[model samples]
Target: MFSRAERKGLRLAGGLTLGFVLCFAGVAAAVLLGHAESGDGGPLLDPYLVRVARFTLWQAALSTLLSVALAIPVARALARQRRFFGRVWLLRLAVVPLGLPALVAALGIVEIWGRQGIVNDLLHLAGLDNPVSVYGLAGILIAHVFFNLPLAARLMLAALDRIAPEHWLTAANLGMRGPALFRLVEWPAIRRVAPGIAGLVFMLCATSFTIVLTLGGGPAATTIEVAIYQALRFDFDPPRAVLLAALQILMTAALLGLIALIGRPDEEGATAGRPIRRFDGRHRRLSDGAILFLFAAFTGAPLIATLTAGLSADLGRLALDPLLHRALATSLAIAFASASLCLLLALPVVMTPRLADRGGTDATTRFLARALPATGSLILLVPPIIIATGWFLILRHFGDTTRHAPAIVAIINALMALPFVVRVLEPAFRTHLARTGRLALSLGVTGANRLLRIDLPALRKPLAMAFAFAMALSLGDLGAIAIFGADGFVTLPWLLFSRMASYRTADAAGIALLLGFLCLLLTLPSASAEPETKGRGNA
Candidate 1:
């Protein structure tokens, strides 16, 4: 597909992707080997492990069910009410939670539903003696719903958007009413996408560490991922940690296999005709209005409470605190470093020659092109905590793990962000290359010159968007940081979590606000620059 220099670049890219995958696998293997050598020959299937596994399964299943069920009406209502006031903005707001830090959103959820929160306050005003507690299982479900519901809705909305206008027009012309229209047109679209969305949500909720740690309240609410963290950090039990990590990988692999069987919904592209006016939902205005209002309130209430709670906080003192300043700097540095690494690792894998490109018809080229991106995204199947645990165990054998924590955290964060970076950049890069490859080649533009002149200008926006996304993801991450954070390596999320754990509610709330603001600031550029991609599965 290219001159010798370009082929070399592609080879280097492939090598990088393989090296990353091997590093991850190597760490996990070392952990397992260490566990085997430890001779802690006790049964792995202890009662506690069993209980944690069961709880993890049920919570994830319940969260997925609730998120998907609720998303249906909200997505349908949004699709039907196409031109309502603030509709576009509402859709945009729905996606904000996707990028919102789990810890930030958890704080927001507590502010809304915690015993002393807004809901309880309203109940008290109404003379109701019983106050609600956003803790334990209820709290976990509420937080999961708050995050995943919007994600599910966005995906379903995108599915509805893909329904050709002619289908709607035909439904109207045939006088197909609510259930009939839904049955014939809407249901099929949703069904095609719902399985993938559900599977993704389930995987996310299953691997949840931050929300489970913060809102879990006690051991009864503990998940496998959190249990692994406890085993490694609190108990210093490498054997137990490795076992839990293995269990998580097994469960995730099984779920992925099941989801793969469902297959992905076909990507919807632009139609070459005028938009057809939707008429099936015209008479269901009142019901749709109520659904819209309920979802909007459900999604917005936590954010509102976060803002309100932080208003009374001593911002100046918090801002001036040296520890807070250090954490902020650490977070920014980590975010920048990880995002840069993610781009460096992702670009080559994405830029590799495809099966159909010139001089790329060989099966060897095709296999590598496909396999390389999969390798880049391989971290998605393995939780960040698992990687961190493996490296932590390996490093502890030789030296103080704290000294090496930041580097491990940075590498894991980069890998975690790699999947998203690849997803965002691969399509855009491929499209650009396909459109301009011949022109660039004819102009004798190859290798460094070609990338500098042709690819750079065309891909600048997407690259920026990918970087912003990668940065935001790393900034908000709690998983790798939870494992690697030490006295000198505290990031904002780690600091915020510490304050919350220590019962410094005011300080925690303040930190939460700051962290949320920073993440949102990073995410805005990506959100604004890129056309919204549908169904960012499990990213």
Candidate 2:
């Protein structure tokens, strides 16, 4: 527990986090109003964009429902079992999607579900004119299920784990099975987590960018974020871009509101209910085995496809592409710089969270820093293409389009991703500082050296984790790069998109694999950090 000052600081931190999230949500809401004057490419509440939104809504809802629904059975089975071969592996797989880059996953989906991809190739040998449709609505749903099922399973399993072992014993004694067992043991778990899972999957689908873009065949299959991209990047219509940003904001906000209304009624004691027992009967064995197999297929196929393609390819050719190399270097540089920036900013924020509090921050500074991230996010929420267009317009007026635009994109990318870094690192920062503040002061350590010697040693894990996460996110990004990417400022993911558009499946597949591996390498360090660092005091 915090002392009064500490409590005030923690409150401020919460306020700031909420405020930041809400501000972004609000900006996403007024997209229509902002782009009311987006001439030419302006949405004008057009049928095309409306169709896109509707499709996004339908596909995402279905995906969310399927994922959460399927997760119930899978979760229950896992919760009931003891440690088994590949059990931990499956749980880890459930969490792998959490680390998945959307673009990478899309590529894997194509390989498995694409027309000329594996499934289709097999189908062709079987003499089918057309194989499965990995395009349009079908493609979008496949990608979502592929991505969200693991998350839902993980959540549901966590929820079901709450059931007490005694419950299972009592059920056995009473001869409970089937619906009776489900009602007594499962429904409660489902009720507790259903709303949250729904909200998570829904928001994920709603705000989707990469999956919809890659899998979506065209404008007919677009999402709001993609729409914002089209208006700004493709058309350079500021008002339209603003309007789309607003619409996105509103839709995202509405989804979040739904979450709040139907929020996880059972977040507390999610694992309070039961001790997951090993299978003791044929029925139990069958149910558990089926669930494991279903989820394994859902979660494992993408990785297998990616590994097969990536490892089987001409990586040499892919790497030789100058643009690919440039993007790789650029991603690393920005990731490093931004990671440093997050650490610098987070250290202060965590140590002095009171600054975020109305009581602590001066009204003026609070207002300034509080809203500063948007200065960078201005590209996205306001439309990146609009910002680029306005800047381009200014340059054109001055007849100086020669100014470096790619630099601007890199800066924006760093800024846009900064908030995420801050969000992830700030908690660990506060927790550490609050607990170790006196220890550090008593040891007479302060300033830069303090960070390296006193703080960094303890913070090495989260620090590494935050840096890796920021880098991985930045690496997979196409948003900022797209605006300034015209002159070939291509990142690996961008390159893959280009290849896909040009029908270069082989090359695109290779790049996707490379990019996925790169992202995983960057992310693994941080993922590995959490278990290694926490609640430990060091000199």
Candidate 3:
């Protein structure tokens, strides 16, 4: 549909994006490998490293099991009770925790389970001697479940929601109820999604940094991500950090290989779709109610606690704190830059293929088109911390590292958001081009004129929504910043983490509240725009 010049520009832009990904990513990988070969002068598998790896794997496995285990019944309950009051809102609520900053959730968990928090207060009133501590392995499990259970449940619920209405009718007509109904109908739907959801939850828990860092009371509970941070920041041990990053990359690659072998579930058959009419769960209202109540309490407590704790702090004084303002400004700047960069890179990458198909059909163009989108997933294997670590080493080789913190953090955060951005925008762009590309070209609408008059106007909603989601994700990010954050380079999460570390509970609460509020504000626009498009495990 494009004129020759426009298609050429698109191809050029796509090539540049591909080059950007390859050049820097290639350099980062090479640096890490070279460092790994040189060694840290310490034994490769010392007792501490072995212990940390064991704990990391153990916690991830346990967290995955608990999250998926609990999510099954909750998802089943949601699918069964389709017409209940607040059902829509309950599903919306589940998405909130997923978008929320990890530090905020960790703070919320602490408010409910910490030594001087609500549970302890209740125990003291009841004459109990020991207070429940949210400061070790137990705390880690709780935090991981709080973040991942909703994710697993939402994914499973989507699968269950897609079950053909005729299947339910068949089960009901057969007088199938309870275990028999599940065995025949529901189990198959849940089973299809369960493994993929489990793998995602496991990876999330495995790479967990802020949650573990906040809740890991000491070395006894530390994960590899946190250990890497300590190695670089505390011990000033770049060699050790490089080693940990290498180990993490290898571990992640192996897990990804396993998931690839297991493969994704086939897409459900086309059906006469509508809201599920689960007739068999009629005899199980009491049991389903109990299940839902437990799920709500388990998930809702942290949210309620986060708000109550944050509001209980002195708002006036907290607002006036200069450091808070500075962090807020820094975070906003970074988030805005990251979101813009994400779109800038994503738009050309997505556009190149459509432009290519219209103008040319060469093997090189086809290969470039296919490969550009997959570049977004590269971050999965080499996460933000490792990227930051690699860049940290590179900067150290040149000069001061702290000076480049904001730019590096923004770039990494943008890359981290790239996959989601591509998912949201690619479909919108494809549809828009299919509908209007020919008509616009017929009218000689091309180049700057077309983009301003046709493309921007037509694509405003998805663009805005994509921008908001990317900004929210960047605003709450702690991984890249944790590696590069310093006294003058603090963001909201880094500042809150520092406060919590220094025993400033009240200050930390206020920061958490502020950060949470900002993230929520950014999330609303995206959620409203494309609610159905989410919870597909794209994040």
**TM-score, each model?**
0.95, 0.80, 0.94
The list of candidate 2 runs beyond 4 A from truth reads: 1-44, 121-130, 267-282, 354-423, 439-453, 528-539
Ten-residue segment with the worst summed lDDT in candidate 3?
A: 528-537
lDDT values, one for every candidate: 0.84, 0.65, 0.85
lDDT of 1 at 337: 91
**lDDT of predicted model 3:** 0.85
Candidate 3: stretches off by over 4 Å:
37-42, 123-128, 273-275, 355-360, 397-399, 528-537
Better of 1 and 3 by TM-score: 1
- What would the per-residue lDDT of candidate 3 be over residues 1-539, giving only the tens digit for each residue? 88889967888888888889877777877887777777747798889888988999999999999999999999888888877777777877777786799999999999888987888999999999898889999999999999899888888888887778888888888888888888878899889878888898888888899888889899999888889889888897777888888788888888887777778787766666554577856777788889988888888888898888789988899899998889999999999999999999899778887755755577767877788877877887887888888888788887777788899899999999998888889888998999999999999989999999999999998899889989999999999999888897899999999989898988898899889988988886466322241235345
Better of 2 and 3 by lDDT: 3
RMSD of each: 2.3, 5.7, 2.3
Query: How many backbone collisions does model 1 have?
Result: 0
Model 2 Cα lDDT, one tens digit per residue, 1-539: 23454445444654564454345434433444444654565436788667867877888888898878787778777766655687766766666666667878888888888876877888899998777998888888888888888777666665555556666677888888778888876788578767877887887787677788788888778887787677766786667666655566667667766776884363433234443463444567777888789779867888898888877878888778887788677667755665565455444444444345445555644654455444333333433333443444344445535355545554445555555666666677677767776676666665555667867888787777767776677777776555555544556767778888788877877888888888888875444221111111110
